[model samples]
Target: MRILIVTNYYEPEEGAAAVIITRLARYLARQGHQVTVLTSAPNYPHGRIHDRYRGRFSLSETRNGVRIISTWLWATPSPRISRKFLSQITFMLTAALRGLTLPRPDVMLVEAAPIFTNLAGVFLSFVKRVPYVLDVHDLWPDHMLTVGAMTERHPAYRAARWLVDHTYRRAAQIIALTPYLEQVIRGYIPGMDKVRTVYSGVDLERFRPGLDDAAFRAKHALGNARIVAYIGTLGTAYDCLTMLETAFHLRDRRDILFVIMGTGTQQQVVRDRLAQGDLPNVRWIEWVKYTEIPQAWAATSIAFWALFNHPLHRGAVGTKMYEALASGVPIAVALEGVVADILRESGAGVSVPFGSVDALSAAIRRLLDDPAYYARCSQNARAYAEQHFDAEKAAQTYEAALLKAA
Candidate 1:
């Protein structure tokens, strides 16, 4: 089988979609399928193309038997609506043009976010007469509204909805990252028997228990303090301000240390708060290599996942939570819906109401102060990861779905 994956981001870029798509492409190639990825030059989170990929219209590379073709797109650091829309539109046009030159595949699997990328896949599928699968990572228009980027009555929102509905109806299959998202898709295109919920799993080999905790702690000079970590993009969707408030609430506790390890548009806001000299117990580290994530997990006692309360977020299931489980660390999440339900079902962590700094601080304290409960949660975390979130198993499921769509 020949599989063509269309996405906005790919390897050397650090994000959940990049990791998932790379893993899937590699796994499918390992299974004797010809896999190729069509993506934009690596410029995400920071919004500037990497030095190596700059000034190039298109470039191609291969990694582990998978072909990667990167096309050009506008780069801007501003999170303004116009800049973001321009970036998406440029990628959509370039990717569609590039797709026309490629060999027609048995199936086309596309990462649908920013929504506009789906246009490339739809156009290619129509021209080539190949079945296309819409792999939805996030629901747009709704997400834009949640972040105050647009309103329901806005012309842009209405146009996005029309485009999304058209794509959903035309897709041969829809791959949703969470059950809630699957439900939402089904609601949009009712009686579509093709939607499936496929959770993004973690790499068990790379992110299991028993890392060099001592070395990590020593390197960071975290002397005998309990570490609670929030390790991912610090973007608008996340309530990072609440995390800062939680840090302030626990600032007097010398034994508790808060570590935030990522960068995004909201970085300056957090930096300003830290500069106020009120969060001495808090520490911020810029993004690290993906390989070094295990070390970060090793130094953590509790993993924190925070998101702003929004209806759009109800369907979100962050990759960080699965990574934390794979690392045998308990979770402390401040969000509702799928993630909270997972904690409740697996007994692997505790959850609190979103935006409640007091509750967030209290949850961290409970995990730190209660050894017996902590041990149980830690054990459950690893067990859950092994049973439910293995990458190879997810790849197999995806392979079957793609084959069926083809």
Candidate 2:
């Protein structure tokens, strides 16, 4: 199959979307499919071009057998509204135009991001008359509304919704990561049979335990403390401020340490709070290489996963949750929707009510009080990740979906 993947974010821009996309693309290519990615230059979180992509123009390259194509576009990577909106539009236009000139693909898989990218993809599919599958990572304009990142009444919100609708109506099939989102999109788009659930996956082998027998602890200064680590984007979407709150709550627990291992819009603010509050049990670290996560996981006694309080959260199944489970670590989550469902059903970890520090405290204490219970959750976590959220399986599902869409 000739597959063309369209996503705004890609390599050098570290996140769940990038990780999953790269994995699927490489796996598909290895399966003997001709896979091509159409993406903007990689600049994410920090909103500037990554070192590899810096001073680079639209270019075609190959990585591990898959064909890589990046187009010139604005990617401000920051949280500034105006510049980000403009970047979205520019990348959409550039990718759409570039995509149009290529040979007609057997299937076009367009990621739903920046919202505008899907709009452009919808347009391109109609113009090219090729079937396009819509991969909904997160509900956009609606997410913006819930996070107070933007107002629902704002023109951008309305415009983004319209684009979302356009893509939905045009898509041959829709893939949603969570059941709540599947229902939401099916409700709004008037679809039923075309939608399927394909979870974002984790590399179970790479994110597994026992990698930190000894070398890892000394390297990261894990010392002797029982570490609770949070590793992922610290964006508004994640609402990680309460992580500090959790740190403060555990201030009296001298043997426990809270380690934050990532950067985002929320990083500095959380850091400032930690500094002013003088929480000696807490430690801060910049974003670690994705490869180093296993060591980080080895250092952690528990893994923390959080999302901002928003209606949009009901549609999210955080990739961090999946990865933590795959790493065989006990999870402490403050999230809603599918994540909560996974925890409850799989017994992978404990979840406090979203945004409640007191609840988070109680949950943390519950796990710490019983080591056997924690180990049970750890076993369940790894078991559930392997059984349900395997990317190897999902990648095959994705291939079949694209073929069907085509």
Candidate 3:
């Protein structure tokens, strides 16, 4: 099968979509499918074009086996309402125009975040006459509004709705990471027979306790304390400040440390919070290579999957959750939603209801102080990672989605 994946986030860029697409493309390519990724020069959460691809219109390259076509898109220094919408528009146009000339794809897998990517899917469904699938990463305007990135009744919302509705109406099939997003789509678009849910998969084999390296930890000085980490985007949707508050609340436990790793739009604000007080227990790690994640694991005692409590978060799944489990470290997730349900079902971690500083602190303390419960959580974490979150499962689910769409 020849597949074309259009998304704003991809390799050299970092985010949930980037990781998801990269893994899927590689996995599919290995299975003898031809994959073409139509994306922009790597500029993401930081809002700056990569130093290497700067000032270029588009560049085509191959990573692993997938053909990557990088194109022009809006680059912003910060996440402003006007700039984000423009960026999505830029991506949709350039990617669509580029994919038009390429060989006819058997399936068009368009990621809906930029919302413009769906424009390409909208065209491919009607123009190229390919069976396009819109992977609903978020509910678009609704999510943007939730994050305060945009207004609910704004013109852009209506425009995005129109484009998405067109694709939803036209596409052969639909995939959503969470049920919450699926319901959101059905509410607006009506017909829902084509939609399906496939939670994101983690490479449990790569993300496990055995990978921990002492040399890497010593280099980063990770040897000094018990680390509780929040890894992934610092975007508005992630309530990492709450993790900081948890750290501050336990300041008396000097042995406990909070390590924040990853990049995003809210980085400056995070820095401000770090500088405002004297919490030496906190360490802000910029971006770390995925290959070096074992270092992160070696250094941390607990992993915090902190997300902003929102309706969208209920069905959302990110790799960080499984990664924490794979590392044999207990998870402390404070953002209430579907995640809590999964955690409770698996007994993999403790859940602190969202926005409750006291609950978050108590959960952290419970994991830290109780040996048997903490060990059970840790063991359950690893067991869950192996049983449910491996990349093999992810690849299989992705393959099934395409085959089913066909």
lDDT of 1 by residue, 189-242 (tens): 788888988887999988988888787677667777788898888877888888
What tens digits encode model 3's per-residue C-alpha lDDT throughout 74-96? 77865676777778778778877
Residue 348 accuracy (lDDT) in model 2: 78
Residue 224 C-alpha lDDT in model 1: 72
Q: By summed lDDT, which 10 consecutive residues of candidate 3 come out lowest?
A: 117-126
Clashing pairs in 3: none
Q: Which 10 successive residues of model 2 have the least lDDT summed?
A: 209-218
Q: What residue pairs clash in candidate 1, if any at all? A: none
Q: Give the residue spans of candidate 1 off by over 4 A.
A: none
Candidate 3 at 140: error in angstroms?
0.6
Sort every candidate by TM-score, greatest first: 1, 2, 3
* lDDT of candidate model 2 versus the reference: 0.81
Most lDDT-accurate candidate = 1
- Which portions of model 3 miss their true places by more than 4 Å? 149-151
* Candidates arranged by lDDT, highest first: 1, 2, 3
Winner on TM-score (1 vs 3): 1
